[model samples]
Target: MTRRPVPEYAPDRLTAYEVPLRTGDALRTPHDIAAILRTVHTGTHIYLRDKVGTVMGTTLFTGDPATVTPAPFTNDDWSLTLLRCLASPSTEELPEARLCGFLFLAPDRLRLYLATEEAPSGMTAAGVRPGGALTALLAALPALLDEQRLTTTDADDPHCARVVDLTDW
Candidate 1:
């Protein structure tokens, strides 16, 4: 089958949300997001919403972090990555969901822009499949933000205190 062209990144088309980072939350870097992606496993449950607020629930599987890719554009102040995911509908009435979106990480918030169509083969060939991973991450963000302050090593060392290593226990 012929494929549709991948649209260029457009900030206007994206919907932005403040990630609600608490005063001492350690989830302040793109590395933290990568760590979260690395932690996702198969059969993770996710709840998704479309532009109009329709909820689509599903369970998804993911490949390794190598499958996740950096977006084409660059912003010195933000971290931008693309996560491609396929959602198998939880109910028969709904169709399968193909999520090809950009997750932009700023120091204080996250900006998400989900394409309305399927991802191009060139993009999906890497196969990161972050549907469940991202959903689980966002769903647990509040708790994660709240719990980060408890993981620091030195309260007096600013850099050391802000370091959060989610890759390990």
Candidate 2:
């Protein structure tokens, strides 16, 4: 892991979006999520959230898609396996699991939080600027999720205002 300064932003408020995932969507696997992260960042800390919205564990992801090892998808153990697999140098496959959401700490002072359709609150972001890495990733996600429309809520909106769980990821 490398040392880096934390980005500055208000923790109590954030801009939110709804990333709806229909059945058979490509964002279903850990590998898929890894690929998405690689597109916007060379390396990133990934925070995986469990059911009822809690941080289960986290791992550093810096692997090529082809080099990733494939693993069986099981709802019960996928999160633990994913943390172990990505942390290991030899094995690197994103196991299959229900991606309720992810908190991605990208390079260049960008912090983006994504909550899938399954989550109660939608996607939220802070410290995002136009044409920044975070902005670029947000733009690309709509298409990556098979062109699912993203509904946005302003940061000041009461409905959008919520506390985001922040980890090193």
Candidate 3:
């Protein structure tokens, strides 16, 4: 069943981040989240470990951005968006997951949304991390673009905020 779109943000509390990303090519086949997991996820994990701290799993989204109503912003087309939560700082110690982020690639740009609910605290901390997904995405982008993965035209970053943005519709 198609998951109904859920409200990811509240008007009273608005928080968003514009991840400055240097775009490359696409990362995987459009809408093929499974394929991305097989090829990019595992490899990207290493980079995330070195850059953004650590992540346990991810959620994927595909289709018209309009389907996601009341969005912070919109894009013409969007495919294979990935969302993951930043887990504990170290594997040895367990703590509440503080931050979460979303990643999506358009034909010409890469957009990242780090939820603001939990202030900027963790491995990657704040702003953009060099060795984080940014680095791994650079390597993975071309592969997706080469495959002509799905993308949007005249796309604008949504600047998503809230755990729902990373975990729900």
Candidate 4:
């Protein structure tokens, strides 16, 4: 059975972001959570990390956990669309997750929410950081997603925040 969809917004709150999709948007095949994830990444899961580990016994699946590979990057309008959605920070405060996809958005740091499935098409950026992912995205998405100037309220590093804008609906 299909599980009920996760709420687009947490109760009593709103996000600064908004996309073409709405809260009623379907979380199915072309527009599910992974769709958002893939949009954040584009065509690869390069953002996902599979760290090496030592096993004490043979009873565990000590290897990397496999994620379904994301689809192609045929969508030319993705970056522009996303940037526009995040262009304007709203006066109505929302859950942090809804605004930045990161938990916090500090003044100095910008919390980047790179989806796990947007790895680079090239083998060179396969595992190591793809230098152009953010650059390419920011350059292209300024107009389409002209919603807010996204910034983070934390030290410059990756970590989960308690709040973010999920109001991209």
Candidate 5:
């Protein structure tokens, strides 16, 4: 994957929210984001860009989410696609949801731009099919954000918190 300089997010724009650890589970913390990310197969990475177009850093998730493997993109490939979507005319009804970005961790470098009129709509990536582990995580994520109040201060675990708070969308 080609590495490029990621722009810094404005302090006012950076915000945090919570997502579910599991269905009906109430243990909400940014730390759990890594566990959710680990659901993806090895060599998979998720890029969550915000509405204002800010990318932070990359987290390498190296665990077995499922037996299947997803296709990998050559770094800039997915970024280019996301740029196209953002540049589209506002009048045009884009498939993108209000607070979402591209998801390109699927097999065969399968790229999908996940936008939701509301979040938790979720999308499939890599070999992680619609009902796969990744899909479940995405579906479960939005609800947690809606149900729980976010912590005002940064969590002690800065690394994992970075992954969870990566998106401003």
Candidate 6:
């Protein structure tokens, strides 16, 4: 995959609450998110970008950025694709939804963080098919953000709280 840069998002600046109101079950904490990410096949990484075009840091999933088997992908590659997707316009008549940034894990794993100029009828970051950029990200992620903390990531774990929410979405 081509390399790209995923921007850094300041959770404080996030005001785009256009998310669909699903059971809080889906919204994962860092540990939970990390778990889901680990489920993906090795040699990949997962990242979450918010609706306001803010990029969070690279999710601390598996081994160090250095010595992972197969050499895990760098955030830069996935980040650029996400940015392009966010900047692209949607042809679909998703009247209630709009494309924001994306979750950059790898091939079959990702999340499509949505945004609405106004309040949303509900909060949902659905997996949407992309038109301009690669749609793999949209296809990879689950429809709803569910709970399930890291298998090893304890609530007491320093990165636990920060893992799922990552300080903030």
Best by lDDT: 6
Candidate 5 structure lDDT: 0.35
Point out the higher-scoring one by TM-score: 3 or 6.
Answer: 6
Give Cα-based local distance difference scores for all models: 0.32, 0.34, 0.30, 0.32, 0.35, 0.37
Judged by whole-model lDDT over C-alpha atoms, candidate 4 comes out at: 0.32
The C-alpha stretches of model 6 lying farther than 4 A from their native spots are: 1-74, 89-92, 95-113, 116-134, 140-142, 145-169
Candidate 2 local distance difference test against the native: 0.34
**Which model is ahead, 1 or 6, in terms of lDDT?**
6
**lDDT by residue (tens digit), candidate 5, 61-151:** 2323243242344334334433343445345565333333444444323223334444443432111122223334344443433332331
TM-score versus the correct structure, for each prediction: 0.20, 0.17, 0.18, 0.17, 0.19, 0.24
What is the C-alpha lDDT profile of model 4 across 1-169, one tens digit per residue?
A: 9998656564323222112333356423433434554554445333223332223421121111134343444333343334344444343643122223422233222333432222222110001111225444444432323233332233333343211222231
Point out where model 2 deviates above 4 Å.
Answer: 1-108, 126-154, 157-169
lDDT of 3 at 84: 24
Q: Write the per-residue lDDT of candidate 6 for residues 28-51, one digit (tens) a residue.
A: 343333433343444544434432
Worst 10 residues of 4 by lDDT: 121-130
Model 6 Cα displacement at 44 (Å)?
31
Measured with C-alpha atoms, the lDDT of residue 90 in candidate 5 is: 45
Task: Write the candidate numbers in order of decreasing TM-score.
Answer: 6, 1, 5, 3, 2, 4
lDDT of 1 by residue, 63-151 (tens): 22344332322332222232321233345653322333333234323322322223222221111222234555534432442354433
> Candidate 2, clashing residue pairs?
none
Q: Write down the worst ten-residue block by lDDT for model 5.
A: 159-168
Which structure among the candidates has the greatest TM-score? Answer: 6
- lDDT digits (tens) for residues 108-134 of candidate 3: 233443333233432211222223243
The worst-scoring run of ten residues by lDDT in candidate 3 lies at 160-169
Q: Candidate 1's error at 23, in angstroms?
A: 45
What is the TM-score (0 to 1) of candidate 1?
0.20
